[model samples]
Target: MALQIGAISQKGGVGKSSIARLIAREYAVAGWDVKIADLDIAQATSTNWKQRREQNGIQPEIAVEPFRTVTQALKHASVYDLVVFDGKPHSNRETLEIAQACNLVVLPTGLSLDDLMPSVLLAHELVEAKIDKAKIVFALCRVGDRDNEIDEAREYVRKAGYQILAGSIPEKTAYRRASDVGKAMTEISFLSLRQRAEEVAQSVIDRLSKEG
Candidate 1:
C-alpha cells in the first residue's frame, strides 16, 4: 500500500497546499511515483498549481487531481508509491477522516497564537477521535525571522503535547513568487530559501521513517 500523508489546516493561507506539493515533489525527485490528491475542491489550489508546473515543463513531474471526497482519492493508493492529500481549509468531519486515513497528518500554522491555538485545538480533536498523536504533527509556516517568537511558538505546541516539525518556513516574497510559477517553496530561486524548505520536507520524511 502507498504511504499516505495529509496536509490539513483549520484555516486557509497557512501553507497547507504548499506543504502538500513540497512532499509530493520531494518524493518524486527521489524517484518515487507520487501523486497529490487535492481534496479542496472549492479552491483547487494544488490542482491549478500542477497545471502551471506542467505548463512550465518543470522537472520531476508530479500528478495532482481534485477529489470531492476522501474515499475517491484513496482509490489511487495502490497506483502510486506515495499519495499526499491536500485537504480543505477548515476542520470538519472530513478533517478527522483524513487524519485517520493518513500515515502522517501535518497541520501547518503560522507563529501567532491565532494560528497556533486553532491548530492545537484541531490536534486535540483528532486525539479525541482516537487518532494516534504520534501521527499528527505541526509544521510552522509563514513565520517571521524572530528567534524568540519561534521558540515561544514551539514551546506552545510542545506544552500542548504535539510535536512540531524540525524546521519552520519563514515568510518571504520569494516563496510566494515561486508558488506563482507553479513551484514549491523548496523549488524557490534562492539556495538559502530552498534549503530551509528542504529541512521541513526532510523532517517529514524522518517522521515517516519512524513509522516503519
Candidate 2:
C-alpha cells in the first residue's frame, strides 16, 4: 500500500520543499520506495533537487518523478509507498486538490505571525473541502532550537484551537545548503539536523499510521 503525503502552505518560502524532501529521505532510508509529485512548476525546487540527486547518485535509495498535472500526479501516487507533493506556496486551487488526494497533508509554517495566519486559513480550506482534520498536520519549519519563536508559534496555533505535530525543524545553514545541492538533511553532514529531521519524520509517520 502506498502512503501519499503532500507538503503545502498558503505562504511561500516557508521550507515546504525542505519537508517534502526530508520525509522522502527518511522513507527511502527505511528502504521504502518514494517519489515526489512536485506541483510547484514555477519554482521547480523539488524537481531540480531530484535531478541533482540522480546526478550525484546519493545513498538510501530514492526516486523522484515531477508532474505538472494534479490528476497525473494522483495516478502516480498509486505506485509508490510514498508520494510527496511539494505544493505552490499561496492560495491555490491546486493546493486544495492536492490536499484531497493524499492520505496525509502537511502544512509547513514558520514562527512568524504572517506565516501562521495564512497557514490557518489554508487549513480551513482543507477542512472545508471535507478533508479529515486528523489527516492534516502542522510542521513547524525554520525554528531555532532554544529560541522562543518556536514555542510562541506553537502557542499561537494551540490558542487558535489547532493541533500541531510535536516536531519542529531548526533553522540551519546546513539545511539551506543541502537543499541548494539537492539533498535532504539526512544526506548532509550535520548529524544534529539529521537527528531532528528523523524525529520530525517519525511524527509524520505517526500521523499517517494513525490515519491508516
Candidate 3:
C-alpha cells in the first residue's frame, strides 16, 4: 500500500484544494500512483479541477476524484500508493476516517488570526478521535513576509502541541492563476513562487517517508 497523506482543515478557503493538487502532481511526476480524494462535499474543488484537467487534456497524471466521505476515500487504501484527502470544513467525519486509513494527515492553514484560530479546536478533535501524533501534522500555508504573524501562528499551534511541517508557501499570483486553470504550481511557467510550493510538497513526502 502506498502512503496516504490528507490535506485537511476545519475551515474553508484555506488552500486545501490547492495543496492537494500540487502534492498529487508531485507524486505523479515521480511515477507513483497518487489519488486525490476531494472530501469537501459542498465545494468539490478537486472534482471541478479534474473536469478542467480533462478538458485541457492533462495526461499521464493522477486520478483525482470527488469523494464525499471516508468510506469513499478509503475503498482503495490497499490499491493506491498515496491517497491525499482534502477534508471539509469543521472537522468532517471523513477527516477521522482518513487519519486512520493513511500514514499521515496534513492540516493546512494561513498565518492570520481569523484563519489561524479554528485549527486549535480541529487539532483537539483529531487527537480525541485517536489520531496518532506521529501520523498528524500542521502545515502553514499562504505564509507572507509578516514574520510576526507567522511566528505568532506557529507559537499558537505549537502551544497546542501538534507537529508543524517545515515548509510554508507564501501567497503568490502564480498559484492563484494555476488553480484557476486547474494546473499544479510546478506546471505553471515562470513560477515566481514555485520553490516554496515545491519545497512544501517534497517536505511532506520526506516527513511521511521517515522512520517515525
Candidate 4:
C-alpha cells in the first residue's frame, strides 16, 4: 500500500491544494510514483492543475485523478508509491473519512484568528472522532513578512495541543503566478523561493518517512 497523505481544511483559500501538490511533486522528483487524488469535486483544483502541467510539458509527469469518494481513490493506491488527497473545503463525512484513511493529515491555515479558529476546531473534531492526534499536523500557509504573526500562530497551535509542522509557506505572488501555469513551488525560477518550497516539501516528506 502507498503512503497516503491528505491535505484537509474546513475553510477555503488556505492553500490546501498547493501544499498537496508541493509534496506530491517532491515525491515525484525523488523517483517515487506519486499520484494525487483530487477529492475537491466542486472545483477540481488539483485535477485542473495537472491538466495545465501536462499541456505545459512539465517534467516528472505527476498523475492526478478526481474522485467523488475517498474509497474510490483508495482503490488505486497500490499502484503508486504515494497518494496525496486534496479534499474539499468543508468538514463533512468525506473529510472525516479522508482523515481516517491518510497516514498524515495536514491542516493548512493562515496566521490569523479567523483562519486558525476554524482549523483548530476541525482538528478537535478529528480527534474527537478517534483519529490519531499524532497523525495530524498543522502547516502554516500564506503568511506575511511579520515574524510576530508566525510566532503567534505557532504559539496558538501549541497551546491548543496540536502538532505544527516545521515547514511553512509565505504569502508570495510568485506562488500564484507559478500555480497559474501548473508549476510547483520547487519549480519556480527564484532560487530563494525554490529553496523555501523545498524546505516545506521535505519537512512533510520527513514527517511521513518517520512513520515508516
Backbone atom clashes (below 3 Å) for every candidate = 0, 0, 1, 0
Across 1-212, the per-residue lDDT of candidate 1 in tens digits comes to 99999999879999999999999999999999999999999999999999899899898899999999988988877899999999997658778889989999999999998999999999998999999999999999999999999999999999999998998999999988888889988888799999999999999999898778
What is the per-residue lDDT of model 4 for residues 80-179, given as tens digits with 9 covering 90 to 100?
9999999898658988999999999999999999999999999999999999999889999998988888999999999999999885788899999999
TM-scores, in order shown? 0.98, 0.93, 0.91, 0.98
Candidate 2 residues 44-116, lDDT tens each?
8888887877777777656666677778887867678788888886647888888888888888888888889
- By the TM-score metric, which is better: model 1 or model 3? 1
Predicted structure 4: lDDT? 0.91
Against the true structure, candidate 2 reaches a TM-score of 0.93
Query: Which runs of model 3 end up more than 4 angstroms from their true locations?
Result: none
Whole-model lDDT per candidate: 0.92, 0.82, 0.79, 0.91
Per-residue lDDT for 195 in model 4? Answer: 85
lDDT for residue 21 in candidate 1, whole number 0-100: 94
Can you write out model 3's per-residue Cα lDDT over 30-63, one digit (the tens) per residue?
8888888888868888888888887887754678
Instruction: Find the candidate with the highest TM-score and give its number.
Output: 1
Error of 4 at 63 (Å): 0.4
Worst 10 residues of 4 by lDDT: 196-205
Models, CA RMSD each: 0.8, 1.6, 1.9, 0.9
